[model samples]
Target: MARISYTTVSPLTHSLNVTKRWTTSLGIWGVGAGAAALLFLSVTPLVRREVLVKVPVLKLYYEDTTPASDKPF
Candidate 1:
């Protein structure tokens, strides 16, 4: 018959390992979230300004060509 030896892990060591894994995953997620937030903040103003600049053009396209006197309001 052959004898097999099994290694046992301590609870504290297991907990520490779990904590380390969670910390690493959270750290990576936090960095990604921060980068996304920064990108959004940086792009938001530019997008808003661009939309603002184009609003008059859009309004012109949609504006009624009929004389104001013909309008009901």
Candidate 2:
């Protein structure tokens, strides 16, 4: 009697494993970058008007209270 051993590895899983072993700080950097992007976008009128203003908790914090005369844009 003979038995065969089959093994399979996903390309994504392999690359992720390599990345995990290569550096532990990679994920921390990625999170920081994402937060930076979110912070930058949060001040934009498009994001404020279309997204942030809809959140009850954040709406007050993001709202623009300056008079039109004082606006630089």
Candidate 3:
């Protein structure tokens, strides 16, 4: 004949283990979310300024009777 023994954890220990697991998971998620927010904020200014820059222009001078051949092509 064989006898088996089972040990049970206390209620306080079980509650502590559950709380530890929840806090650890929450901390990991919070760090990831914070990093994503910082990256977004850092990149936003560069993207927003792209549309506000002006293009360069050149000025030309010519006579009313200037022929097409005399103009800069």
Candidate 4:
């Protein structure tokens, strides 16, 4: 009697085939867009408190430095 064997496609290979070079480029572009959005939102109050304030390096940079006399809003 002879043994029988079967070959199967791997998950990694399947995924690689489903995604093309353009998909990888699009992912890189998406990351860049997200970073740009975060940078633009950095000065907003919500972002400052929730994101910048927690960062050790940016914490000092985002601190309120103005005096009461200069603050009107």
Candidate 5:
């Protein structure tokens, strides 16, 4: 009778491979999130500012009415 033992890949090798994959995935996710956040912040402020500026602000000058104001279309 003979005792037999078998081992596959080493535990250290498996853990290192797993770590490499996890880091790679995290790197990709971080870049994607940073880009999305930048785009959102950059575009939202510009759109809001444009909208704010477009709103009509009427200033009535009681002493400055001219003939152009009298002409009606």
Candidate 6:
């Protein structure tokens, strides 16, 4: 009978990372919204209103001047 010898293997280790928390201030968003509102108010009057004019179609052909050779059957 032969005796078998087993060796213990070491486990792998991973590094842990820590990140800082990010935050936003309300002043920037408020100023941006205010500027956008001011720009929209200032540009509103520059846009012109569209007006459509209806016109009648004119036909300028006489039936009496039709040639016999060029007339459609």
lDDT of each residue in 1-73, candidate 2, tens digit only: 8999988999999999998886778878998998788688997889888888898998899888999999888
lDDT by residue for model 5 over 1-73, one digit each (tens)?
9999987999999999999989989999999997677557644646435443354542231122557868674
Whole-model lDDT values for every prediction? 0.71, 0.87, 0.61, 0.89, 0.64, 0.41
Q: Tell me which residue pairs clash in candidate 5.
A: none
* Candidate 4 Cα errors over 4 Å, as ranges: 1-12, 16-27
Best by lDDT: 4
Shift in Å, residue 69, candidate 6 = 63
Residue 37 deviation, candidate 6, in Å? 0.2
lDDT of 1 by residue, 1-73 (tens): 9999999999999999999989989999999997677557644646435543366755464344779899888
- Candidate 1 segments whose C-alpha is farther than 4 A from its true place: 43-73
The candidate that achieves the highest TM-score relative to the unseen native structure: 4
Question: What TM-score does prediction 2 earn?
Answer: 0.44
Question: Against the hidden true structure, what lDDT does model 3 obtain?
Answer: 0.61
Candidate 3 backbone collisions, by pair: none
Clashing pairs in 6: none
For every model in order, what is the number of clashing pairs?
0, 0, 0, 0, 0, 0
Query: Which has the better lDDT: candidate 2, or candidate 5?
Result: 2
Can you give the TM-score per candidate against the true fold?
0.43, 0.44, 0.41, 0.54, 0.41, 0.27
Which segments of candidate 2 are over 4 A away from where they belong?
1-37
Q: Which model, 3 or 4, shows the larger TM-score?
A: 4
lDDT of 6 by residue, 1-73 (tens): 9999987554432121111121244566888997677556543433211111111221122113557899777
